[model samples]
Target: MKRWIPWLAAAAVVVLVGGGAWRAMAARQQQQKALAQAASQRAEAPMQLAASELVGVVRRSLVLGVPVSGSLRATESAMVKARVAGELQGLTVREGDSVRAGQVLARIDATESQARLRQAQQQADAARAQVDINQRTVTNNQALVNQGFISATALVTSQASLESAQSTYRAALAAADVAKKSLEDTVLRSPITGQVSQRLAQPGERMPIDGRVLEVVDLSRLELEALLSPADSLAVRVGQRAQLQIEGSAEPVVATVARINPSAQAGSRTVPVYLAIAQNRGAPALRQGLFVQGLLDTGRADVLTVPLDAVRTDKPAPYIQAVRDGKVAYLPVKTGARAVVDGQTLVAVEGAPEGTVVVSGRMGQLREGTAVTTAATPSAPVAAASAPATRPAP
Candidate 1:
């Protein structure tokens, strides 16, 4: 009975081991089948992209421009100052008043000048009377000498006295002329035709020689002083045209390059280029000291271009995500001048063809060689049983 019990136990252990091995084999087969299924599904699935996420490359005629910023200034401006010193009697012109050349802008006290002129005139008259008396005396002496009533030496003395009197009269006349000029200077006049920008003196205020009285600026002819880098300056030339975007003006003002500084500015490498604004009817009125931005047209050429936002420049070599044969491909590109067309900034590129399709935005997670579906033709939904063997035609 004991031997029979041992055999029975051995058979029971064998059966238990066989059952455990079969369970392990079944689990391994299930796992293998699941992995194979997953791989097949992934291979058959197509990456999908919406139509709104794509942009097409196109050829465009780009007018290359160099960007510059500066301020607008009057082409002709002057600081009107007091040429002669006097009490400011009245200022006829104020700031922002339009004035013509030789217009009386201010008046000074002319009482003192008038008095000096009168005194000089009186002196001149006295000198002239004295000269007349000397001439008569010389004439009488000559007659007396001719009649043998006077010596030659006496005649010479009379002639010398007459000459001295004539010299004194001439000096007095010169003084009178000076006084008259000083009186005329009492009235300050505008040297230019323009609007008055500033008023520095008031009526009844004492002014010194060359004292500032007013500032006049010709706004009709305005100019922009654009500062450019060394490289950009080399490309600029006189007579080139540009468009100026002033701070307050809604429309861009047209300008022409009038002059370029021969040398760079002191303490900096920037060069000053002056652009003269063209006055056109229906254009916004420009004022001095207004900040402005400009685009100087350097050249124009036809080139393959794409939307500015489509190109990625963060990498050492710029690149764009281009789709080819239903896959996203990373294409390296070299970019050049940029232009604004219809309010969109388009950049000139050298690599891609004109009809290439590229991912324009929202490319954070996109990878190279990623399968994709065009926004125009979306991929079919995954079937409940199995994925389609072939993708649908785009």
Candidate 2:
């Protein structure tokens, strides 16, 4: 009986070991199957994206233009200068003060000018008295010659003396007029209606002829002068519109090409173009010398286009990611003019047909032939539905 017990125990141990080994093998097989199933589901699953991530290539009017940037300037600006040399006085207007045309802006000391005018007037009076004496002498000589008290040649000589004195008197009067003009110039006046931008000369300062006093600018008419290459200038025409972004301004201002310089700028060979601001209620207030940059719309064209960022250059050739047959397809494209339209910059493309769906570069790079679907589609379901939550008991 003891020997039989040993054999039974050994058989029992063997059975227990075999059962455990079989259970482990079954569990391993189930885990492997689950993993394979999950991989298959993942391979079939499509990448889900938001509707906004997708953009359609469309044929639309793309604004064609060249970049232009320059400083703003008032169309009507004047540099007030002193016409005569004297002491500056009564200069109350400072920078930003409003002025009217012909308004008295300042005055120069008139003491010297007044004295000169008096001197000229006194000289003219003395010359007039001499002219009167000459006329009387000529008359007396003529009377003597008629009475045979003097020869006719003596009357002719008296007439010549009278003419000479008259010429001197006329010369003195001309000098007096010049002195009067000089006195009037002492009072400086604003030549145009505008706001003072600079006050160069202060009261009690000595000003010379042609010395700068104030700089006034009319803000009503503002323009930007941009230098463009000769090739770009050839495309720009008067009345063509552009949108400009001014430094320190939040809103963009619309401007029109006002004029084009006939001759190129020296040394640079760049043509200068003037752009006049188109005033509107919503536009921010602008000032002179503000830096502005924008695109000058030279023309427009209807072409297939996409967001400029979508044109990827990572490859040797420029290409865009497009969804065709539910898979990502990279299509090489020839890029043309780029412009801002509807506030988004678009580049003209030639490879993609109109109405083809394309992905934005914001989505990052996507692999070719990868299945893609929008969140609105029903292709993707929860993985738990297909994945085994628990393995069968082994």
Candidate 3:
């Protein structure tokens, strides 16, 4: 009976040990089952994304171009300067005043000019009288010489005096014409039909010759001057089109390449490209010296492309997050050239076909295999806000 008791105790000990092992195995199985259920629930829940967080791939003509920026200038501008030195008078026009070609804009005090002109005219009149007297004297001397009443030497001396008087009279006439021109210069006229952009000299102020008085610019025709790199400028040609965003203007202005500087700038070595702006009706008027920036369309290419912001570089290889079968899928792409389409900067890329819905960089990183739906769907934004925040696997 004692031996039987020891054997039974051993069997009981084995059974207790077996029961503990069974409990541990059962608990582990329950835990794993619970984790699997939770994962399935997460997967079933679709993340709702805003419309701005996604962009569609498109295949269209991509405008290949170089980025350019510069200031707007009037194609025909004139600087009205004083041609005569005198006190400015009758100057009524100011900045923003309209002017017409050959219209009298202002005048310098003509008192000094008129006096000089009168003096020159009087001198010319005196010279004219002297010329007439010299002619009469030459005729009388010739007659006397012919009749032998005067010696030949005396007649020759009289002829020399007459010649000197005639030369002086011609010189006086030239001086008078110069004085008349100076008098006319006192009256300033607009060389072009446009609006005055600047009024440098005021009325009653003494103006010197060639002194700037007013600046006139024809807003009807404007041009943009852009400087570009040598390599980029090489591709630029006359007649290329560009869209410029002018300062203070809401609508973008269209411009065409007009001319290009043959030689590069000395210090910066940049080429200057002039673009003539086309004035469109109902568009905001452009002004000279306004800041402008745009892209010069050098060429065009038709290809599948996406917004440049859609290409993600946060991974070992450049990839874009695309929605495939309603799940986030990372697509590896080989990027090509960048271009602007419809004013948006887009990049050419392979591995993605047209009409593929891809995530925008603004959406941040999303986990693989995650289900996604647009905000228009019934899913609430609050529910899926945390879904997009999921970090990608390393």
Candidate 4:
């Protein structure tokens, strides 16, 4: 009985130990199952966004410009020069003085020219008197020849004397006419209605040859000359609407393309185009020789444009993120016309609403079906409000 009791005690100890090991293994398995279920739920979770990550859209007027740039110049300018060598006795006008065509401007010394005129007149009178006296002699000599009181030789001499007097009178008359013209050339006059920009001669100054007297410029009308390449010139045409900013004017002046050069300069490959300012678009302040910059509206264009900030270009191709169905989705878009508004150019998107919000956040980092609640971007301005050509020059 003692041996049996010892064996039973050993069996009971082994069974108890086996049962304890089993309970421990079951508890470990239960804990591991719970951990796995929790991990699976976490893997299927959605991402949330911070409110501060968004930016606002700015709208402005986007003017399509076919920019052709060049300088300005006066339409009519003449460098007046002295016609003959003489003393600049009298100068009537100063620089900036307005003058008319055929108006006398200056005078030169004419004492010598007057003397020549008088001398020629006296010679002509003497010749006329001599011809009168010779005519009487010729008449008397003819009668004497008929009466046999004079020889034929004497009659021929009388006729010759009358012819000589006639020739001398003609010669003297020609010299007198020349002297009269020289005397009249002493005073000068303006060629056109314009302001004298430069005064090159002074009183008592002797001018020899074609001496420049003054420089006159017509400032009433102005022309703008623009130099552009072949392709650009081809795009713009005559009579197209053009907008330009004249130097020193905060506002821009309006003009129209007056002329286009069909042929281009060979070496520069540039064409010279002219723009005439519309009178209604300006005041007296806008004069000639004011440097200007301009753009021509080649034609009207229809295009879809969106704020550049709403579109992301950090990638190889341009794309925008859109919020749909409680989530953020990476939408691939093809971009088109780009126009500047408040210094931002909107990249065009297809089939998009007129004022749609493209996710400007780091949504490029987010995948499709991401849980998102879009907070509106700050409201700023509409781009068309700031259009460049809306207002006329003041």
Q: TM-score per candidate, in order? A: 0.76, 0.75, 0.72, 0.60
lDDT order of candidates, best first? Answer: 2, 3, 1, 4
In model 2, the number of clashes is 0
Model 4 weakest 10-residue run by lDDT: 385-394
TM-score of 2: 0.75
Candidate 1 has its poorest 10 consecutive residues by lDDT at 385-394
* Consecutive 10-residue window with the lowest summed lDDT within model 2: 383-392
User: What is the C-alpha lDDT profile of model 2 across 253-286, one tens digit per residue?
Assistant: 8999999999998999999999999878878888
Name model 1 segments beyond 4 Å from true. 1-46, 147-161, 324-327, 375-394
Best by lDDT: 2
Top candidate (TM-score): 1
> Clashing residue pairs, candidate 3?
none
User: How many clashing pairs per prediction, in order?
Assistant: 0, 0, 0, 11
Please list the residue runs of candidate 3 whose C-alpha ends up more than 4 Å from where it truly belongs after superposition. 1-60, 313-336, 339-345, 350-394
Q: Write candidate 4's Cα lDDT for 261-343 as tens digits.
A: 77888889789888877666344366555677866766534545555567776678656666666676666667644555566
Ranking by TM-score: 1, 2, 3, 4
Model 4 ranges off by over 4 Å: 1-64, 120-175, 261-263, 280-284, 304-394
